[model samples]
Target: MKDINEPSTAPLVIADEPVNSEVIKTTTATAKNSSNKKSAGVSSQMQLLALAKNFVLDGGLVSSDKQMPLEERTQKRARIAALRKQENLEAIIKKSVNYCSATEFTNKADADWFSTFTELAEDVSNTTMQNLWAKILAGEISQPGSFSTKTLKVFRAMSITEAKLLAKACSLAVTEQTKRNIRIISGAYQTPGLLNFFSKNREQNITFSQFSLSYADLLILADNHLVFIQETESNPMNKSESFHFNFNGKPLTLTANKSSCVLKFYKFTPIGSELARLISDNIDDTYLQHLKSALSENFSIIEG
Candidate 1:
């Protein structure tokens, strides 16, 4: 895998209108009285102008009005963009902090924090947010060091199949592992077309009836390692034909006539971890207690 920290050779492009200095001056004065404490830093005329200039890049006017100087307009636009970016970064940080502090299963605080994060991630249009969330979830599921490097790589794979493939293809390029894992996991379906169907339609909506049936088959294959086979018995019933060994150290039970599978594993106590960290961090216990109560009231574990 390429080192994430490597600087890209791609060009940086900024195509936006210039900032309006007069507007910044006026906005800063009004921001002084605003309840948003963060914006107060731009209240000073000099600070506001500096911020505007720093934010705005090219010498472009905020408005097409020929009366306004291009520099001032550029400054204004830059300031607005900078402020928006600052707000987004702050929100992400706050969400991450809150997520790290969560202490129980189904905590509303954590859920709320993650929801905010997901929104921000969508806005940012990047994989970083998803990666972070996956890491956090994995941490919650297993003890530190319990998850192998391969498992972590699988966690970061593009999809469930990709993750499994990556686990199996440790000898090859990291990118290929995910694809290989998917093939391995889906290899045993007696219906030879199942893999091809998933490959082609993973991103689309199919007929509801077909989707329902396929979903059941996929679930059985994924959870119970079963392969569905054709038969003739007046009314041949679909039965799970197991072909793989259970590796997760759990009793695997097939239910709903091979439509569902469940496994029992040690649950991670996220709430407990959060609580301990919060107490140690000396943050206000009241917020922590409130979040704990809310989560307890809302979430229930659906074992599978």
Candidate 2:
């Protein structure tokens, strides 16, 4: 009876120990789970921040998609892309324009006069047409008869056959007197009318010698007399433009005068001959000015 009242000591002891062990295990597991959950939350927040930074760098926004409706987000992305593309295109255009200006043709054969004619033909504005005719009259067109009568008529409402006849007639009209004038200055070939016009009853024996330069040949017509023809790149820098006249078998020193906006020629020493005097004494400044004015009246500046 005493043993029965004592209760089952072994079973109680085993039960109590098992219950305590289970509680301890449960508490440890719960603490580990909580720590893992916190770590995961922090990692997720860091990932979101990184994503947001990347979007901003790429000209976009974080949560932009979620905040805006699907249609609005799509439209916004398209607009941004379009704007970027437009800016790129504009930059390309500006670069191309600058290049064209710097590298345009310098030869008379490849002159801008012909291009003007083509542009006029495409769009026959009265002002443009008149300008084209003026340039032609100023002897700007190097190959007068290169285009067919049909082309000319289509270009200028004139009869093709009639225009061809007129061009031939003009070429034949070149006189011997003009040829003599051009021969005196450069011994180089010249059109008959041009020769006659330059030589017209002048006793002053003008002579020209050609010298090679970086951009174009320099025509030295006696000492103070020089014509510098340079091939300039169409760019604003005008890097292709340079001077070329010989001084003691070397090029003359060139210096730019910022105040006058003109280049000053200096230190020219031709080996054997004295430098030729400049033709300013006999030149008709007024007539030359008028000619330039007339030429400009016909030509219009076209954006490259």
Candidate 3:
């Protein structure tokens, strides 16, 4: 059916396809896709330009001599730098052994003892942990048999500062416990030097201040099961005096402050005595003689 020349209405052909709702939807989706591509391309170009600008401002994408020193800038090598893996860590630990024992170092014993606590090494990899570990180990080695499994457990339970305090206190029990024929004062064996050093005007007495422990320090030791402070029935009227004992061949004196406070005595537990053994064994003969004479002068046992 051909309309040759008379103004033929052959259904104005907009396109070859049907102009349905589906066609409209497809056209809209294609337009949206094209718009999204343009937006993405613009965003990508902006990011690239920003990166390039930043690079130019920051030493032109290269660290020149003025930007950084050669010491700070190590060149890359064909082989990568060693990574810090378990193997590397173990290697470092083993290598650290060489720096342990030297004559100049006071903690040589401690440095070597770290091997026993190798499991704790991870906690001490940094300087802070290393320092804490060194202090603890130093205390352990202060007395050969002082550090035990129990001590290790206790140390882990506390901070490094408290552990250091505990160790320092432990080292101060410098007298050995030995049976001696001495006078009993107030129903107890009293050392003469103990009384003499505590007498009035004690500053005139011989100086012995090497291992002076404060009330607080004693309390700390007591808490640790080393030594206990036994208050002898707090008597407000009773004033504890001071005395001196020969330590390190020096007449070291301890003067109890004259206070109407309750009298406290240091009673060494069995474990405390064990700790003392490693610190001092041989008592000075001269000091022993002095203690005996003082006790005799102070008390006389009356035969019933």
lDDT of each: 0.32, 0.29, 0.38
Per-residue lDDT of 168-232 in model 2, one digit per residue for the tens? 22211111221211111111111234335465332211121111121111322212122222211
Stretches of model 3 off by over 4 angstroms after superposition: 1-116, 120-146, 167-172, 177-213, 231-304
Clashes of each: 21, 14, 7
Candidate 1 stretches greater than 4 Å from native = 1-67, 102-209, 212-304
lDDT per residue, candidate 1, 1-304, as tens digits? Answer: 2112222344434338644656645554454344234433333443433444455532332344533576766667767766765565555455455544346453223444444434443333123434344444434333343333333232333343333322222211011112211111111111224444455322211121221224443343333222122211112214442222222221222221231122111111222122111111123234323322322211211212
Question: Which stretches of candidate 2 lie above 4 Å from their native place?
Answer: 1-66, 102-304
RMSD of 3: 27.7
Candidate 2 TM-score over all chains jointly: 0.17
Over 185-243, each residue of candidate 3 has an lDDT whose tens digit, in order, gives 11122222565557543222111122344567667766766565663222332233433
lDDT for model 2 comes to 0.29
Scored against the true structure, residue 135 in model 1 reaches a CA lDDT of 44
Cα shift from native, residue 71, model 3 (Å): 36
**Pick by TM-score: which candidate is best?**
3
Using TM-score as the yardstick, the better of models 1 and 2 is 1
